[model samples]
Target: MTDFDQFEDEDDTPKSKTQIKREMEALQEIGKKLLQLSKSQQKKVPMSDTLRDALNEADRIKQHEATRRHLQYIGKVMRSEDHQAIEQRLALFDTTSAAYNKLFHQLELKRDALIGENSKEELANYLDEHPEVEDIQTLRNLIRQSQKEVSQQGKTTNRKKLFRFLRETEEKRLGLAE
Candidate 1:
């Protein structure tokens, strides 16, 4: 048989050089996406400890060319990981996802509950449940300020602050904080 005929008879066909390059580029893009995620967001993503270290190291590199080289290294590390799983977790961060919306509303509800009519009891219970809250006085003050804003038709600055505090507390509790 001719060389071309023998090659065609093989069950496994080799990918073209262009196709291999495209795949490597795709993986590199995935690595870039992982780098773009915030540290808090990265905590939620599933990846090897090695890959995580590589990405963290990339964060410390300030020069453009050094960062580019680190990105390529991250891409290489990503090759051994389950990229699909990483992408799935990343998708949860999208605002349109039901999971994202649910967590957001839950945090808002907790914020409102803290500032509700029975705020004293709510605050007590919340503190008991989340001992990670280091500054109880600040939390109490924010709740009081939020309550005042709601009663006096003031701007929602304090309410927003209270919500942020609650969100950060939750993140710390879940080990998702930066």
Candidate 2:
């Protein structure tokens, strides 16, 4: 049997002092290494485009790995009959939805900052030229009303397809497939 199996089968037998000490030392070493890595990463700011690109690639790889693992877990859940699998899938869906929401919020913040920094005429002209910017209804309405007051607009705004796949995926996850 595995070590975990043996441990689970046993009664309230406390771990041996030596085992406890060894585990504690191992954890301490892990903690030390984590601290050292954090310190080094903090100190090593990228000074060149190459280093920045390398860091971006590393981050992309890490995110891809995480997404792969999450997909594997979902696939495993799909194959299993356990109720826990349903719960796990729901939890994963919630996490994915929250992440997307956070991303959209950050994008909205950036868009707002850009609009705020520009002059009224400049912002209206930009909105007229980039009609897709109005696809975000709330932002679009705000810009539309503001444009009316300024009257130095250029052209009409139009909606563009955005987050359509994400919406469909979310719908499927919630069992509201259409």
Candidate 3:
């Protein structure tokens, strides 16, 4: 007897390969018909605004799901036991962090330029333009007050220097005469 006959006898239930393929194809066609019927029913149903919003949200969620899968793939790559893969992932992380820091620093510099210097006029103008910076007024006032004090002190020191020079010259002339 052939191996096929040895595996199955007349009493056994036997399905030919062609019969199995045809059955599978028939089931697939039925599934497609069912899917089409469901789709037609869905089209017939009226969509409410809330349902439309929910569907939009669902689309956004699906997009995020795709992103999550991509992140998982990256995680898997990072989690690889291979030394080269781990090192590559770590290098990528470091490079990304450095780039972020550089970009942040550049943004900070731009923001600082917008704020301008600590000059009183600049501060006042900025405060006038951006009322949200009211908290900075106190610090600005302090800076202005300190600057005034320093200017006053400088004038006093200059006057003192002139006075001392005049007094010294007079003393030197008096000594020459004596």
Top candidate by TM-score: 1
lDDT at residue 127 of model 1 (Cα atoms): 88
lDDT agreement of model 3 with the native: 0.39
Task: Give the alpha carbon lDDT tens digit for every residue of 53-113 in model 3.
Answer: 3323333443766644533333322222233432332232243556435544543443333
Clash statistics: count for each candidate = 0, 0, 0
**lDDT on C-alpha atoms for all candidate structures:** 0.82, 0.39, 0.39
lDDT of 3 at 9: 34
lDDT by residue (4-79, candidate 1, tens digit) is 2322325678656676666667778888888888887987887899999998898899999998888878877877
Q: Model 1 compared with the native: what TM-score?
A: 0.60
Q: In model 2, where do residues sit more than 4 Å from their true spots?
A: 1-96, 118-178
Write model 2 residue lDDT over 90-150, tens digit each, in one string: 3333435565466456444434433443635555664565554424455545554444433
Candidate rank order under lDDT: 1, 2, 3
Candidate 3: worst 10 consecutive residues by lDDT?
74-83
> RMSD, each candidate, Å?
7.8, 17.5, 30.7
Of candidates 3 and 2, the better by TM-score? 2
TM-score of each: 0.60, 0.21, 0.20
